[model samples]
Target: MTESRCGYIAIVGRPNVGKSTLLNHILGQKISITSRKPQTTRHRVLGIKTRDQIQAIYVDTPGLHRGQKRAINRYMNRAATTSLRDVDVIAFVIEAGRWTEEDAWVLEQLKNYQCPVLLVINKVDKLEDKAELLPFIAARNSEHNYAQVVPVSALRADNLTALEQTLDAYLPEGPHFFDEEQITDRSMRFLTAEIVREKITRQLGDELPYAMTVEIEQYKLERGVTHISAAIYVERDGQKKILIGKGGSRLKSIGREARLDIEKLIDGKVMLNLWVKIKSGWSDDERALRSLGYDDE
Candidate 1:
């Protein structure tokens, strides 16, 4: 008998539910960039988890949100919803502190799936008393008939081992979707963009997080230095000015911080050039969206 187990699992939830954080924690690497804002992830990212006997082919989908008025925003929402097509299991992440219409809406979105679903109650560390958890757990059980209700805190790494154990029990036996040593499916260019995007989300406040996208236009490996150029796209001229800052100090800081991480990522000194452009509502513009690689209409 073949003893190996592997299957594709989709992570779906509303904004700020810690989906990316959990993926990074499980893989023991930063495959996805995370921040305090919602809608930080603009596309679906694949993170592969392999052990001797089991491998979890995890798909980290974007947080569900109102579809973008433009073509690009449409792609982002589709990236989250489209993963349900051929998955073996679905992991719906939720903040345990409260159950809202949005939570119920996310569960209702899964009514179309025949695959087993796990209700993952994240942010458990925020609760100190066991009694504080009783209602949250019950609320989830009442809202959906989940294959398993696993409580975990992505920030604190709580109950994640139990999650893996439970996932093992329900997954169908199959060959690994990726090779044993594989960890992520994103390219170096995509990762470089993501790294820049993460810093942008942290530095820029408000809707800037959703309005921004990064692209690596050039990456050149030179002697003792990796020369790179990336474009930061925003929707308005005000954003461009804010990002560039007075005397261009703000943009310089973002570049410096992202360059440091890029140096570590490529294991070489980096010479990075950052450019900020206004796309005149790129998130809502289909043509601009397509150019940005989210063009799937």
Candidate 2:
């Protein structure tokens, strides 16, 4: 019998670098919520993929950011940094041909780590000048001696097989930590909440997405259908008004989109209820952050 190999792989990068997209493509499913906006992912999500003799547990963390003025920012930073510990390999994902100060800051955090880091240059599909990629790769490689550098387009699923093969070589040999059938460690309720949050991020304009969060107030299964009631929490009454929109149209649209996705996720009919509430400075309050499920641990 062939011995199995399994280990944890932490996917870290600056916000909007496609860390969530990479994980979703690699696992061939969407376990993490993603949007065009930065900071769409606020928690640590685990996705496990088992192939024959290799099992790679992927840890998708919140994008590491320099902003810590708010309690939510601090919590997100801690969640991203804490995922670095106890991982067998780290995939430091970055965008192709684009680098920022935040990317450099994230690299600085990896300086002290002992694990082998694979510099994953994501979004290669968007690079019109393919010839420029080599020079860009070389420039990044000069910054750090990555264990291996793999360029991939997470959205287009480009060069992912090679990425997987490269990752398989670095994972340590061990038994699988989770069942082969398991795709993610997050609960269905958590996923439901995230789906709702993703809709808000995609549908709403600037500032409203940052000001609000979705909480699953009630989730239950009756007969063959799932019933869910979620609250959209905002810091002020004015924000609540924006979320609800004129005649509650915006909130209804959010619910419609979220409910469709939730049905696909749960693989059943779904009845979703959403309401906007004023949480009054939840993002800046530590206790409020904890109460809204932003605990780092």
Candidate 3:
């Protein structure tokens, strides 16, 4: 048998550009949480894509932008930029609906790279027609000169096979980087945190979701119910008040939804108890970021 081709593919894009959605769709599982809000992703989440002769280890980086004045933000920004290097193939995902200066920033930086990159123009469903793709593609390619421009509607599952085919050719031949059956590189605890975080991102408004962090404090399986307790940390008491709501109704709702999602993700019954607390500038703290796995160094 011929050796399988294995390589790392980094999907880089600006915030809310559907990077996580693309990863989940490609994995055929919801390994990552996606939202319409900016900066919904904060870490580099790796999702594995395997076929008969290829294993694509994909790293989905946090959306690139000028970060908040905090260590964690810096750490996140660094992680996004760091993954750009040392990859066999790069996928530059664009929203296709909006082209911001940030997009230009990414394309400009990538233009200097010696490696091949596939420009993934995501969200084609938002477009009107194929003829409309020219200017958008031209604008980007005119600047950076991508290896190949492949349009894909990741949310709608359009042209993924073509995207995969391009990747298949670009990646180098080697032994598989991960087991063919594996989907993601994150732990259950990490996904649990992300599951809760995703719910928060969808339910809450303003900057509450970004300022918060979820930690699974206890997880015990008893009989049919996986009893779980999680702590949602915020930097201020006012934010905690909003999270718990009056009579703890909001917290209860969040718990029920998160529990249901956990049950689905783990394929087991779950009894989740969620509690919120103030961490006092947790996002800005280097220690807090490190503890949450956003290590800058």
Q: Using TM-score, give the best candidate's number.
A: 2
lDDT of 2 by residue, 176-292 (tens): 889999999999989999999999999874858588888999999999989999998998888888888999999899999999999888789999999888988889999998898
TM-score of each: 0.94, 0.98, 0.95
lDDT of 3 by residue, 183-221 (tens): 888888889889998888788947585789888898888
* Candidate 1 local lDDT, 21-49, one digit each (tens): 99999889887999888778878899999
- By TM-score, highest first, what's the ranking? 2, 3, 1
Best by lDDT: 2
Q: What's model 3's TM-score?
A: 0.95
Candidate 1, position 77, lDDT: 74
How many clashes in each candidate?
1, 0, 0
List CA RMSD, all candidates: 1.8, 0.9, 1.6
Off by over 4 Å in 2: none
